[model samples]
Target: MRRNVRVAAYAVCVRDGRILLARWTGAGGPRRWTLPGGGMEHGEDPYGTVVREVEEETGYQVEPVALLGVESARRVIPRRGWRRSAVDHQAVRVMYEVRITGGELRSEVDGSTDLAAWHKLSSVGLLTRVPYVDTALRLWRDRPPTGRAMGSP
Candidate 1:
């Protein structure tokens, strides 16, 4: 198996009892709601990455207020084509609490996410979403002093 690692940043923007989410259309899976952020560019700071991703996905300029926590997940993906080996995938996600600074709400065009919208925090579970959404929210709500989610390594 081949090992693959990805590090990405995400923002949890909450206002008026709602959370901002972008509908991810990548990964060739069903579209699902996720935080408005993504992988960093080469040599890019995670702080800059979160700001850039949020703007690209949701048309909002955001300023990260605090570093909430970091979460890591690992999984195995079987080979998809001939001569390819199974992949041991690990994702290191950095979560931040951000506040919107400017820009109108709009969907990204020809990007990984198609739609951006605000959903009530209480009703988030009713929608189809990526697991990252919940994990990130927990980090935001819990705000553990250690900067790690409860029970997380």
Candidate 2:
């Protein structure tokens, strides 16, 4: 198996009992709601990555107010065809608490996310979403000193 590691940044923007989210339309799979952020460019700072991604995905200018935590996970991606090897994929994700500074809400244009919207906190669990959404929210709510949720291994 080949090993692939990805580093990405995500924002947890909660306001008025709602959270800002973007609908991911990548990987040619089913769409899922996720935080408004993405992978960093070469030599780009994670701070810049989050700001740029938020704007691109949700048309919002955001200022990261605090470092929420990091979530690292490893998974195996089955090979798509006979010639390719199964991938050992690792994701090192950085989460941040951000506040919207400016810009009107709008969907991204021909990007990974097709729609951007704010959803009621209570309604989040009713919608289809990526697991990271819950993870990030937990980090935001707990704000553990170790940057991980309480009792999380």
Candidate 3:
């Protein structure tokens, strides 16, 4: 059995009690609201990836303010559709909380997302945010772990 893994970066751009989100139009024709970010390029830092992705997708410059958290999803893929084969796939994503530094909001003409907007924090749960968005929000809402050094004597 072979497994495929994908690493992606996402940003939770929050401002004035709202969070920036993008509407992702998938190949399957389903649209989903997601945090502003995307996959990391080869040899690119995760933080940089988030900044570039946010700018590219939302046309806003963002600076990562905090390291939120990481999430992973694993799924089995059929080698063939019903009559075909099977495969294994896993997707790992790192999410961060970012603050807008500059630039105005504009959608990229050639992008996976069709729209970008800020949604009220209180209404986030009511919308169709991607799974990682919720995870990132939870991490942001909760303070990071605090303790002594791992190997302190």
Candidate 4:
């Protein structure tokens, strides 16, 4: 079986009891909320990648405070899009707790995500979110030792 590993970074920015999120519009699925970040480019620093992706997706400037955790998932996806064959995908996701230092909320143009907003943490349950959202929140709250990153590229 063909296989590929996709590594990405995400931010959990919480301030004043609200969490910052970007609305991800899928190709065939309903719009769902997700953390503000994306895949790291080749030769790109993860820190720089997170900064750029968050800005691109949410229009907000963020500073990564601490690494919340790492989440990984694997699944079989028909790889006709990248023009690759049927394959397995392993996503190693880096999660961080970030601080929103600046910028206004705006919609990302011609991107996978469109809207960016701050929702009450308590009310986040009512909104449809990607699974990683819950995982990030739990890692942020639990603060387990195993969740801490030693040093990630």
Name the regions of candidate 3 deviating beyond 4 angstroms: 79-84, 146-153
**lDDT values, one for every candidate:** 0.94, 0.94, 0.81, 0.87
Candidate 4 lDDT score at position 18: 96
Q: Give the per-residue lDDT digits (tens) of candidate 3, residues 32-124.
A: 899888888889999999999999989999899877777777889767445555658887788787888999998767788989998999999
Model 1 misplacement above 4 A: none
Candidate 4 lands at a TM-score of 0.89
Which lDDT tens digits does candidate 4 get at residues 37-85?
9999999877888888998988888899998889888889785766568
Q: Mind giving the per-residue lDDT tens digits that candidate 2 earns over 1-153?
A: 899999999999999999999999979899999999999889999999999999999999999999999998899999887799999999888999999999999999999999999999999999899988999989998898888866455
Off by over 4 Å in 4: 79-84, 148-153
Residue-level error in angstroms, candidate 1, position 90? 0.6
User: How far in Å is the alpha carbon of 54 misplaced in model 2?
Assistant: 0.1
Residue 15, candidate 3: Cα error in Å is 0.9
Query: Considering only N, C-alpha and C atoms within 3 Å, which residue pairs clash in candidate 2?
Result: none
TM-score of each: 0.97, 0.96, 0.87, 0.89
How many pairs collide in each candidate, listed in order? 0, 0, 4, 0
Candidate 1: give its CA RMSD in angstroms.
Answer: 1.0
Where does candidate 3 have its weakest 10-residue lDDT segment?
144-153
Cα error, candidate 4, residue 61 (Å): 1.1
